[model samples]
Target: MPRSPWWGRKVARLPERGTLIVSTDLQGNYEDYYALKQIYADEEERGNEPVLLLCGDLVHGPGEYFADPARWPDYLGTFYRDRSVDLVLDYAEWIDHAKTVALLGNHEHAHIGGPIVSKFHGDEAAVLDIRLGDDAPRVHDLFRSFPLIAVAPCGAVFTHGAPRATEPDLASFERIRYDGYARTAINDMYEEGTLGALLWARYAEPEHAQALLEAVHEGEGRHAFVAFGHDVVRSGYEKIGKEQICVSTSFGCEDRNKTYLRLDLGARYTSVDDLREGEEIRKLYPKA
Candidate 1:
């Protein structure tokens, strides 16, 4: 099936005035999902509407903890798929408020044979059977529509992984233009180890970060910053270069290890702070 025309746009512009964007990697953790809801609610209560951008990994793939024999069957059934859908529904308010933009993560790509295919082989079929089943087109559509990379109006880039470029330069990045075919382009970058394959990347060196910022600025014509979440950094957000920031929202199932990035977006300046050891929504919704 052809993808929606919306995904064809390479970069999306945020509100010109300013918008707070909450970027996080929710690896199918109910606690993190609920915490995100509270974050959005809290921001709304403060009279400041914010954009909630999910940096992918919304569903824990079979390559994750599902490898255990006890969890494989359930994961293949509806556990992961249902949770993925629930995450979207929980943030549906942003769909209208600030317009939530969910990027495609490596785990999300695993369902459609991205880099993780080598590890899960046949298990991918189980995911397809449930997510793309006759009655679940909506779930499949949601994943299909997710963009590989999202560029904010302020020139900030939000992606699930770091860009995959061999050379840390703006020229190399400019060559990687997103003219539709995003899935294929991302997969090719993953295969070639280029900076454009943000979903499959793990780390960005200082040079890579500099190159990415320049590329975004030159290609999009604005001062740009790149923020991504993939590799978990227990210490909180890390600055690879002056223009790049990495955050690990998942603390590996430990309550003490949780942290996320609070971004203050402005027409002139963009700032980010590490929010660590904060309140968990589980305290309020015991059943959730």
Candidate 2:
């Protein structure tokens, strides 16, 4: 098995590899949450292993709250908060699972992926302190703490939304600041008073993805595979050339009755879909 290319240093000891259960867009979908728990429990009973990775919108939906951060909690309400915390905490508690990582989606930004202003009712800092607390791998600080989770050796980049491809890989994956093309999106869509707020809106149209892939391939070194959620991809995965791959598992539970990607580190070095379709994981979550 190859090590994560993003690390590029000494290969960390690979654990006894197992099946990974990738999911996202619950957005307070408690039933789906419980179903996943049941699935994981069954996997454990059968002695099969499972891990989880989330793309975004884990808590509130896009329309659940206003863009203003100050009114975040008022919009989130107590019910939403409890559900979000519960689902996240459940994954952390899963002992037999390999590991878990989730990215902050556009819905998380109270201001809807705008500039880093004091938008949320408790502010980003206060929310992190209060909501996350002792969990070193917390969910609130998606960009700052766990921006990009790399699992496959072919340099897969796991992010919440479609990153501006032209941005430097290290910079895009390493910091809280939304610079480069994403920044341009913020400026053109919001700061300059553009008609449409592009950042707030998820990337649905294919032209934007084309632009993103062009930007991504511009970088040097081994290209990083980008996996994200937001756009509703019924099939759960999309490929740009042989390098960039995007997955949308949210459709399954809500409308399409599907789940997210399950990657196998021991698989061939290619797109995220390839990893998910690897013999180990597919045997369980077969795509019909």
Candidate 3:
């Protein structure tokens, strides 16, 4: 059977007008977390408000180490719990998970604490922070099940990582659902040893990135814009083609600098920018 179109697919329903702030490849740097919070605050100060879209890697080091929550609950829970509390509900209005959206990166997928070699295996993956004899799901579960395709009413598709060129499809957001796993395997297949492992770490190159965009644009909605994080580009946002956009906010782990995206549906799906180097996002969308 033919798959449903990406545009107007409605994988998940969301508000028409809201800001999307996304970051990826964060190996759990404390400083980046602080900066991300500030970005959230700035967006709230701005009239459009915002949804924090984190592509993955919330904690530091390899993901295999995180499979056991009892082992690193402090590392994972501290960050996750703080965010849920630190923000005063009265400040920026939001619905359910509307305030935050997250997806698992290679690190989170690796189980965060397993044997070093297992890090490259997908099926070996496990959720984080749930094994402490707890009754509820933990942070890892949230990222694992994140919708592969996030379609904004404005017609934008957001994914954690970009797809590879062999994909060769455009104009469909649904492709992201299956392609995401392939992208993860490719990350694990960089080479025979450690060097290849390191090379596969970042998300870049044009071919794969473009294929994913084309798939999403198939939706044929208002704007077929594709937003994503992963693969730190010194240049930041990249226009792979007329209908695709890639943005990275993890300006490296040590650098205090951070970048996030913002979108306004009412504006004909035309405006998109990176907020970094301490610039206030409120300038474009004033706080209501």
In angstroms, the error of model 1 at 20 is 2.4
lDDT of each: 0.53, 0.43, 0.43
State residue 177's C-alpha deviation in candidate 3, in Å: 8.2
Clashes of 2: 8
Off-target runs (Cα >4 Å) in candidate 3 are 1-14, 45-47, 62-98, 112-137, 165-223, 251-257, 270-288
- Model 2 per-residue lDDT tens digits across residues 22-83: 56566645555676666656765776665455555565432225434555443232122224
In candidate 1 the C-alpha lDDT for residue 196 amounts to 38
The stretch of ten residues in a row with the least summed lDDT in candidate 3 is: 1-10
The candidate maximizing TM-score is 1
lDDT of 3 at 58: 51
lDDT of 3 by residue, 12-69 (tens): 3345666666566555444455566666777778765676656554543335444455
TM-score of each: 0.67, 0.54, 0.54
lDDT of 1 by residue, 38-96 (tens): 76677767866566667877765345466455665521322332254455444443454
TM-score: the better of candidates 1 and 3: 1
Predicted structure 2: lDDT: 0.43
Which candidate would rank higher by lDDT, 2 or 3? 2
